[model samples]
Target: MKGLILKDLITLKSYGKSLLLIFALFLFLGLSSGSPLSGAMMVMPISIMAAYVTFSYDKLSNWDCYACTMPMKRSEIVIARYFVTIILSLLFFAASLLSYLFTAVIMQNFSEVYLLIPSYSVLFGLIMILISLILVLNYKFGPDKARIALILIFILPSIFTALITQSNVPMPVISESTIMLFCTIMPILGIAALLLSYLMAAKIYQHKEF
Candidate 1:
């Protein structure tokens, strides 16, 4: 499993230039916006993109077929992919946190960091849920179809946001207690979703033919 994860990481290293460019771009946006949260928002998409890049590479190389010939179980392969996703999520989350801190310092708003902790935690949870969905879709449908589905999934939020902005409907006022409850529950739900996704992916991979 470790070897499988290492393989994915080494493969991803070849795309270091592109990733650095993206990082710089987001960092600049964060700095320019002067909002640490804005910079941190880049965490989810980038991490998801990294995960999909691995899937694309695997599909291009027919990696599953080759991997099946090795001694490891299929479940291990699925688990390793999850591990890679989780690892990438953490790495990007940490990077975003650092970016947040840097932006805060530049803006002389370091005190807001404490206030933003809950938001950051919520973002982390959302990232996990998104990654879990990506894993399950990739394992069940292959990367090509999964890409289309995920694109729609990504677009729904924007479409909803646009509609909400144009509508006369009033937004509900959420209390701090409710917000706290949501922030606390989101991570727990995210964890549940990830474990469920793992089970589904393992089952799919077990019966999957290369």
Candidate 2:
């Protein structure tokens, strides 16, 4: 698994400049525009791109076929990929957090919109859900069908934003108890989603022909 992660890190090094540029641009926009959501926006693309690019690299270099001949189990390969997603997601989450802080400093305002929730937690939760779903779809559908994953990366976020906008529910002011409940539950749900996604991917990979 460590070697597997190192391999993905090398793959990332080959194309990571573009990812950095994208995040920087978004960070600047988020800070300049005084929109807290903008930084959080970059987390999704960074994660999905990381996952898809790793898979794409494997296919392009015939790494999957090569890896099967190595000593590692198929389940290890699947879990390693899951670890890569978590690592990349955390990296981008930190980038987004810095952007949020810069926005607050530059704007001299830290409103309830920014303070109602730990923005990093929200972005992290969203990334976990997005990555889990995307990886499962990628495994089940395969790379030539990657358009499906790409479409999903965009669609799910849009739908979520739309639902929030159309629901017309004002953002609620939470009691300490409510906040505690959410803090406890959200991580559990995220973990459950990741575990389920890993199981799904492992099952798909087991049946897959090299």
Instruction: Please give the RMSD of candidate 2 to the true structure.
Output: 3.2
Report every candidate's CA lDDT: 0.83, 0.75
Write model 2 residue lDDT over 20-75, tens digit each, in one string: 66667666877766775666467667676777777777778998888888887999
TM per candidate = 0.94, 0.81
Q: After superposition, how far is residue 129 of candidate 1 from its true place, in Å?
A: 1.0
Q: Largest lDDT belongs to which candidate?
A: 1
Model 2 residue 44 lDDT score: 62
lDDT of 1: 0.83
Residue 48's lDDT within candidate 1 is 78
Q: Put down candidate 1 lDDT per residue, 1-210, tens digits, no spaces.
A: 889989988888864545556566667878788776687688778887777778999999999999999998999998998898888777777777777777777778665666577987788788788888888989888999899977876799999999999997899999999999999998998899899999999999999988
